[model samples]
Target chain A: MFPGPSAKCARLGHFLFLRSLTTEATCAVTRTPTLPVKQATRPQKSDKTSISTAIVLNRAPILTRSSTPFETAYYSYQARIRRALHNPFPYDFYFKQGTLIETRFNLEERKRERLAFGPAFLSKEDVSEEKRAADIAAVEQLAQQEGEGEVLMPRTHPSDTSGDVRSLDRKGQRNLYLLLHVLENGKETWRFPLGKVEKGQFLHQAAQKDLYAECGDEMDTWVVGKAPIGVYKPRQTSAEAQQASEIVFLFKAHIMAGQVKPQGDHIEDFAWLTKEEIKMRVHSHYWDGIKDILSDH
Target chain B: MSMQVASQAARHSLTRFQRAPKITRKLRRHPKTGLPTPHVKIVTREFAPSRLEEHYHTTLKDDLMYMTYKHEIGERPPPRQIRMTFDPEDPYSKYRHNAPVGGSQFHKKPAPSSSPDNVVRLEKIQLHTMVKEAVANKSQLLSAIMQMKALTGETFQGGGHHAVEGIQIVRAKKSVGGWIRPNVPVGVKVDLKGQAMYDFLGTLVEFVLPRLRDFNGIILPPQSSSIKTPSSVSGVVSFGLPPSALVFFPQIEVNVDAYPKLAGMHIHFVTNAIGVGAQDRARALVSGFQIPFLRR
Candidate 1:
């Protein structure tokens, strides 16, 4: 289903996915010689010269996918929401561990699509003019530098979980932030990896620290989107007291690169998954957090 | 919208998948124990590991006979075939793989009567002894440690023996977190030296854990040697001693271990009782093998 007439409405619905480039090169690239071409820069992050007797990767660069506006919007909301939930303000009571959200804001949802591209979405509750501009500047700069990629792993809302989010939000507008990232055919679900955030650590820092700690350090992340801030209490009277009352900043990261290496004594292995898949595999609240990241952004 | 934020989160699914154990058919049993439990496994595999190359075959494949010592400690059931085994000739076939020599050995074949009586050559490692898990965990962890040191924030001395977090781990961060934890046990080694079974065992006793850890529900007191025994640190541990005194004592060592806490384990220890009291203790240890509480 696609919108009609209006330029913005012309190819509105994201239902029709033309993923591959196998068709005759009708000059999508060839015709638009003037269109911006952002090369996937291999960030020559660090030199292994000292470590290797003969460094094979002299220019070994870490290839990062170009950022998308959808992803920027998602993360923007996530950081803000997480910040709000963790502050000394009394609003912490509202933030939940599993903030169920529907796929109410995918690229196809007409209202969502409209709001997604709006300056308002990024500007919401973002009071500090300077900080907001800095954030937007990063998004715009990344957008100009965005590389080419197919929307490969597109997930649709499942029937069972479709109405669950709508039922959870008190606003009755449907908290569409619990959907998980997955392959188009529904392969992997975006589930939170097993990790712990030490005290006095930033939520995002915790995400990175825990990742390196539990999952191998090779875990690459593509910030797909962000969601509303969630106040995730591990569990009342649980042993992980430090985690018992803390905010969770959830973002949809694509395991776009690297291997799922096992590192920690507590971990067995690591995986990249979508929400529906998590429903059948992982029996944990981490799945709910992943769902929020996919949907909220 | 911050690239700094999203950039860090984006890891390739391919990278994670590639690092995952080459998944074949999902295993029904555990990678460690054949028990159908998740803690015992993360990899879904049919066999424990291909690395477990210790297989024992006799002229009669089904006549699985292990070293009387291994059976004593219950590293595995007195050798049995992959499946139930019984001679075709026996009515209703009531024997198992380790059952005495029957009319037919490997099934459909006549019982092997020509081979030497004790000619049980190592055929294939059906199930692993403790040493096997070390082999599996070490090699796998070795590669991971290397990759970890290669991470941006991770710190390490490459091939050196400096510590990582708090433990004496050799490697540090490579990436962020994901799904599936390696069910295989990982112990920090001083070098790859601890990767070896004997060395790993030394670290476990001398460092990671102390004696009198626990057996079943009881806190086992470490056995002090009235006289020195001919066993290593692991051998001393096998005696169900306290975690404090894991040093070798003058006794047949017991081989009991757990990750850190003790709820269940295989009890390996020395028994001087021979002849008259042999059958009695053998029966008792056999029963102890099943009920950890009794042995504790």
Candidate 2:
């Protein structure tokens, strides 16, 4: 049940926080008003032309939510404490070869994701900080300068709204960072694509499936590296608090080729945010734990 | 990985020629006479042909039969059969030696049919440290090597082959200005392979990595490799061990008196293997041994 007046004030505070972030999002959307989803097929301005490609991403801007300072601090502290206590080795110590049992469906699901997501671009692997920055800027520029029609695959049937149609929107896609943010019952939150580790599925494979299910057959969007970025345990709701909590595995993916479309209605909406924008928009508690990782990118 | 390549090449050559055979002779005493019999017996042994050769032979036979039948010709001679004879003193042995005795080094170890779960192993653990100060003083280098050996329980090796000094030390005072010479051998390294590697890995994964300050386990980015077609350099996860964190290792921490200076080093794990999905297979094999992969 919702708390009394204090909870309402907290909610209002949260709303204000998001509103500030939304201003940035709205500016991006407004700049490219004429750009529609269908024009995504055509090639646009060269990414090398940096001047025209300022951050004009006006896609789903945030609407501020309410939260008390105390609540925010509490959650942040809780996360920090949890991280301090987290020990990944104890559970993994009994490791034996071939002990990781994976199911066929799960394996296929992971394979499909890897096949569709494409190669990931690591911020650290390729040498030269200047070059990596230039690449990121170029991608951001391309995503911004391109007309909406130039990047989007044409919408399929008019009747298909909350189905698999969006996921099948593979077309001439350029490399862009894919961030799946959830608007769960109007509470704005950013979470990378993730799902339950199915029976017989390895942790990494499950992450791939979750990413692929959300992004569809977008090339270079799949995670290829055998490792995960981090393991996150989300706070549970009161109703589900008694149940086993879910652990999230964040993977870095790049849009090597072909665009992506959302699969089903489980997610409210998705957007591609720049690394800086992600840092700014994510919840404070989440960001505190993930800032190091995001900085690497 | 190179071993696998050599085995494949050897198999290729073995299939192209008739294999050498071995002959054995035995004499038996007469049952009633209690004396050796004059008659001699001879036996011939041949290596089992590869499955590929057998398949090739059948297909070749079918082709010859079809040609003979199609032309409606008279009796066609049997296809030439190459006889493989063993000769211990054959001079050709110099150029082409017989296959190594016993099971193949490439054979699926333990048992061919058994599941290859533990086949992937921790090949080695290499510890490296860069001591820029050692470049100026020769004694410093010796001390650094001694410290490293004390920590790793293995003899330290010499200079790393790096182009253009990867490290730079700037003199803030400007009086001592200018960068240090480039490409200097300022570091010593030790590679703990075989059993030593496993021991080091066990200690690092189970104890050191977990306790290292502000340290998260190594991350394997999914984009590093694709399962459909693995690249030779794919599936390699490399991370650095900061000097600040090295002190936490049980061996190093307890013997703090030995190390006057600390240096950082990089660790790289090459997970190359055979077959489709080799990258993932190698990763899973590593994880099964309890080394947690930090997802990033």
Candidate 3:
């Protein structure tokens, strides 16, 4: 049962302005001075109101998106325009004459020129074939020594190829949300990690505690703000409806390092899913409630 | 045999004609100016993908919207009238600039109600440096100007954009009794926008900041510092980099000896955020770019 009006007022005063108040406390305080109009309107419902906090743990993109073919073409065209209009490079300021580095730069510049224009656009050099060949060889040797041709890490992770949903590394260029498959009312359901808000708890604080209680302390996570980003109201059965109407306040959090370790028996499994994947797993009504909150990309 | 010899002679003449080099048309010089006339105005745009720009669109934009969102039940009421305004209709002040009664209390103005379109974003970065020696002799400003040009690689109207004032010489506006004279150049600055801004930010974070010795982070003001200030409302986060740190810039590092003197610079990150506590929001956006901030 809800606390008495006098007790609630004292608790409210103690917590005021230090942390943001819960919806019930906020409504009560706003109306307490005038009249207990909210309590009078819903006498029985006020005592059985149920509130829970959910955490939307997120992983931001790791890699920059690859440009589409059209984008690539546009960039190249712009680059060509830039090259043609660029001012002359001050070679004397940056490079010494007859230095190997300068020689390498000159060779690279000619190659880029050929790519921008064509081989036919370049004037024929006065140097003999052997000298030109020697310069090329020297530059190649320098490049080899400097490890310039080392391969970069591939954009796609191994987990992506294997279709491992649990691995956080699966999607390198998409926002991934953490969703849990939990046993609710003897039925398995996919939802954000949810836990009941204890008495006198701030919603934001409850969100953090709930996340750790379900997801374990292995990961370092930061709740985004004091306010909840969104809310979800679950459909109630006749029996449950008679007991309490449930409300879930969803808070966004970022997982900086480590993976979620589902601690309790209530949480059956967990997956790092993109927005579309989440839609496929969660109920239609639930999706309708939270779809707008999830990022598209 | 006579016919064959005639045919061979004709073929040889045709081959010689084909081998001859043709003369190309030259660009005509303008009659008034003596400069070669080109048919078109050339403008160069973004030539490559901007990583930081993409990161903002993909990640930071969404996170910022969530973090800075203030939930409201209904449309915000019109702001309260703080002071009376001078009537323009008054005969004495009709032509004069009628200032507000309490001056423009811009610093105290409330932030615009949160909405999708008004999310804060960086507008541009301004790099400014003052050359002390330039006050003695104007020629000393050349080194600072050169340094700005080198650091940003911006030339006057370089990309054919008229608004792009690549690097500018800052001249004194008023004469101080003995230290300075009006119209004398004492400093240089460059404004970076678009791809150039992101590129500069990336270079600063990746190369310059990490290498600075004994640097913790851009320090924050004391906890009780007043938020109601012109700078706090203007949404500009300004900081200074010492002259010794100038060499850490990869561009300057390449030819450090070329510069006669290095001057410390003030960098201002100007964002689109406005109103009370705007600097806090701007700081949030900047910190998203991994420029760390430390509290005293």
Best-matching candidate per DockQ: 3
Candidate 1's residue-wise lDDT over A1-297, tens digit each? Answer: 221121121121111112112211333443354643421221111111010000000011112223355555444444333332222422222223322211111112334323323333332443488854665565455545665243653222343354343221112211122222333234453434434434333334444455555446664643221211233333233333322223343322334345445564444333332234345664367545333423221
Tens-place lDDT per residue, model 2, A1-297, is: 542332333343345446545644554565574865533543221111000000111111111122344444444443333332323322121223222222222234344433322223112244478854665565555546654235543434232343432232311121123456666667877656655544444444555676666657544543433344444555556345323223455544434455556676766666554456567767877666555544221
Runs of candidate 2 with Cα error greater than 4 angstroms are A1-297, B1-119, B156-183, B222-235, B270-279
Model 3 - which docking category?
Answer: acceptable
TM-scores for all predictions: 0.18, 0.27, 0.86
Prediction 3 TM-score vs. true: 0.86
Cα lDDT of model 3 by residue, A189-244, tens digit = 99999899877777778889999999999999998867778878888775675476
Quote the chain B TM-score of every prediction.
0.17, 0.45, 0.87
- Runs of candidate 3 exceeding 4 Å displacement: A1-47, B1-38, B80-89
Tell me, by lDDT, which candidate is best.
3
Task: Output the TM-score of candidate 1.
Answer: 0.18
Give lDDT tens digits, candidate 3, residues B133-228: 989988988888878888899989888999999999998999889898889889999999999999999999999999998778889999889989
Q: What is the TM-score of chain A in candidate 1?
A: 0.29
For model 2, the DockQ equals 0.01
Per-candidate count of clashing residue pairs (backbone under 3 Å): 76, 42, 0
Per-model TM-score (chain A alone):
0.29, 0.38, 0.84
